[model samples]
Target: MNLAEKIDKILANEVPFLEVAIYYLDFTVYFANLLFPLFLFLSVIWFTSKLANNTEIIAFLSSGVSYYRFLRPYMIGATIVCIGAFFLGMYLAPIASQGFNDFTYKHLKKGKKAYENTNVYRQLNENQYLYVGYFNVTEKTGTNFTLEEFDGPKMVNKISANRIQFNEADSTYTLFKYKERRVGEFGDELISEAKRDTIFDFDLDDLTPVKYIAETLNLNELNDFIAREKEKGSSYISRYEVVRYKRWSLPVSAYILTIIAVAVSSVKRRGGMGVNLAIGIAIGMVFIFFDKIFGTLAEQSDFSPFIATWAPNMVFAVLAIYLLRNAKR
Candidate 1:
């Protein structure tokens, strides 16, 4: 459906074909990063269940192979998959995530509904602060913008504009209906102008930035971004922290899911492979549900991002251990 919608847009010339193709590639990478662990779990369950059904597992056991010895190959396979997933989360997926979101906002949606942070408040530095009531990224404009400068908790100067626009050609900001107030030792000096062009220390990108911008950065970049956001006391820092912790959590989940899948499918039963697959799918869905719930909590509430990211893995790891113990008998 997503592809079809993009294709329709392409046919209507609403979006460029090359852009859609690039978005499609990026989307594929992002989806693979999310689903590969689940797919590997299912694959292990299917393959091992087949072996069990064919009596191959029984034959091996009868030939004096311990269950622990039998698990060595599966653990080795999981280790390989875990390493791949780590690379995807740490490096490749971030690049794809950046491209995917960029295309979605810039071309596919045309920046119609892309601004999540409509009213932005940020302390640019110890002395400078910025506020924007509304920011239109497509037009590179902000409405009801105000910037204040302070010196040791004392307000020094303030600039207010009805509208501010970013000029790409000259890389400057043009403030319309601008007003400025400067605090003097004697009194306050006020100035008003119809329009003013001034260069600010910040750019349009600093205004109402995307919440998931951290997801687009590699590990090193993400760490730096989080640090910067923390220094600025950004409310969205939790969202960034969630993404950072999730990179490690996702790779660890592969081993947990693998153990659960193997334990649930190691025994041959009346319904054969389908039963195992059904159970595996159900578990996968539940795991996803837990992950999403905790992730949202971290993003929207004051939940600890580290705990939110790893909660599902921790819960399921215990389940995997219990199931593995039962299966060993």
Candidate 2:
């Protein structure tokens, strides 16, 4: 087939069917990806135009046999940018997006879910702490919880309760259906059948800043949270650790995207730079959409975060390298 035929075939394949949401989504992301490169390419053109307008190009061409030689450095720079964006978008972007989106959707959005608002653990001191089974933000109540005092890694006292309610008005916690036991230097004793409102002097630190859960964290915060959670025997720490690693991998995408842009738009053709930019945008969008889709796959299943994040970079890096070599020749 001719070049036109091949190009047509590729575009046809890229254009998604009207009936498929995934296809439309892919198109949306692909188009979005194209915008960055188009801007970059235009900026290149703008600079080139400035040089040409100011007679700089003429000066260079007057001195040298070919003006194209001056473009070599720009091409090399673009290549470096491409590689940087590719790594950033392909790996680092996905990871950052995962954490960033979760933090945004979970906390920033209105109408917080009950489950999201529930459960809080706090540290009162080196050896004293509290736990709430559930904290209902709407009702300002927590149910089925415990308060414990540890003396040098040994439990000295345990307080168990069927329900604890936080009085938001006074910033205090009240225990209901409670039992308290002490086994310290004074020896074992029990206090039972407690009913009170605002009985605890403890500040609402146990439940304040209600959005302190694991999902609200970025990569570094997630790492710190995981370590703290591990010390407390939190089973969810492993999951957060996986997410933390993924976050660090996201910034590499900017490099990956830069490569794809440069590789595709660097060509000089009779059809003009516009066509090349359009093509670059179309291809970039597809890759971006794929990145997000792969991310969702990782979230929904046991997909390797590294593979899911880096696959687009790998594929596009190969493609960019091929295109760059072809353009150079």
Candidate 3:
């Protein structure tokens, strides 16, 4: 479906050739994280079923090989895949995620309003804080903007503007209907201006923050972001936490899915490879369904993000163990 959509865009000349190439590359990287485990599972089922049908597994058993011994090679292969997936999840996927989103908003969603978080609050530094009631990234403008400068627990200056526009060429901000207040030990002084142009310590990226900004950050950066969000009492911290925990959970799932696939297809059946593939697909769908449900629950409700990220893996791990035991017997 995704490829078809991109091809349609190409045929219609809706996106540039270079952008289409980058989009395909980014989508491949992003989907690899989701599809690799499923592909591995299906491959394991198919290969093992072939061996079973050929009596290779029975031959090995008759040669006094223990079931666990027979499983060593499969486990080793799963470990290699797990490591690769870990690397992708921790490093490459974040870069690809950012590229994918950038391309999407710039080309596919041209002239459409991107849903940016309204009423953003951020600590620019130890002594400065910023706020914006609403910001439009495409327009490079914000409404009801404010900047407060503090001096060791006391706000020394405050600047508020009805609207602020960012000048990309000059790297400055133009404030309309702006007000400034300076607090002194004795009293406060206020100044009003119909229009003002000044340099802000921040930039356009500060004004337009992405909701899934967490997804674009590597693990170390994500941890730092989540810590800062926690300090600020951010309500969306759960969403970031979900992305962080899923990085670990997804790689670990490769091992679980590998074992489940082997156990399910190691015995030759009357229906053969088709039956094994059908079973594998069904299991894969169930795992995805559970993952989506728990992830959505965590984002929408008060459910623990750690639990939500790991619940799918835990459930499948138990299933793997059960199947392994049966297969061994």
Per-candidate alpha-carbon RMSD to the true structure: 1.9, 12.3, 2.6
Q: What TM-score would each prediction reach against the true structure?
A: 0.93, 0.51, 0.88
Ranking under lDDT, best-scoring first? Answer: 1, 3, 2
- Each candidate's number of clashing pairs is 0, 34, 0
The deviation in Å at residue 165 for candidate 1 is: 1.7
Worst 10 contiguous positions by lDDT, candidate 3: 108-117
TM-score of 3: 0.88
**Which sections of candidate 3 miss by over 4 Å?**
11-14, 112-115, 149-156, 224-235
Q: Whose lDDT is higher: candidate 1's or candidate 2's?
A: 1
Residue range 1-329, candidate 1, lDDT tens digits = 88766776566656766777888899999988888878998999999999989989889878998888988899999999889889998999999998988777666665367555588888788888889999887678889999999999899999999999999999999999999999999999999999999999885667967866888899999999888777665778888899899899998899999889889999888999999999999999999999999999999999999999999999999999999999888
The digit string of per-residue lDDT tens for model 3 on 1-329 reads 88676675466656777877888899899889868888899999999999998989989888999998999999999999899999899889999998888887776666665555488887777788889999988678899999999999999999999999998888889999999999998999999999999998775766676776988899899999888767644567888899999999988898999999999999888998899999999999999999999999999899999999999999999999999999987
- Which lDDT value does model 3 have at 255? 91
Q: Give the TM-score ranking, best first.
A: 1, 3, 2
Instruction: Choose 1 or 3, whichever is better by TM-score.
Output: 1
Quantify how close model 2 is to the true structure by its C-alpha RMSD in Å.
12.3
Q: Quote the lDDT for 40 in model 2.
A: 59
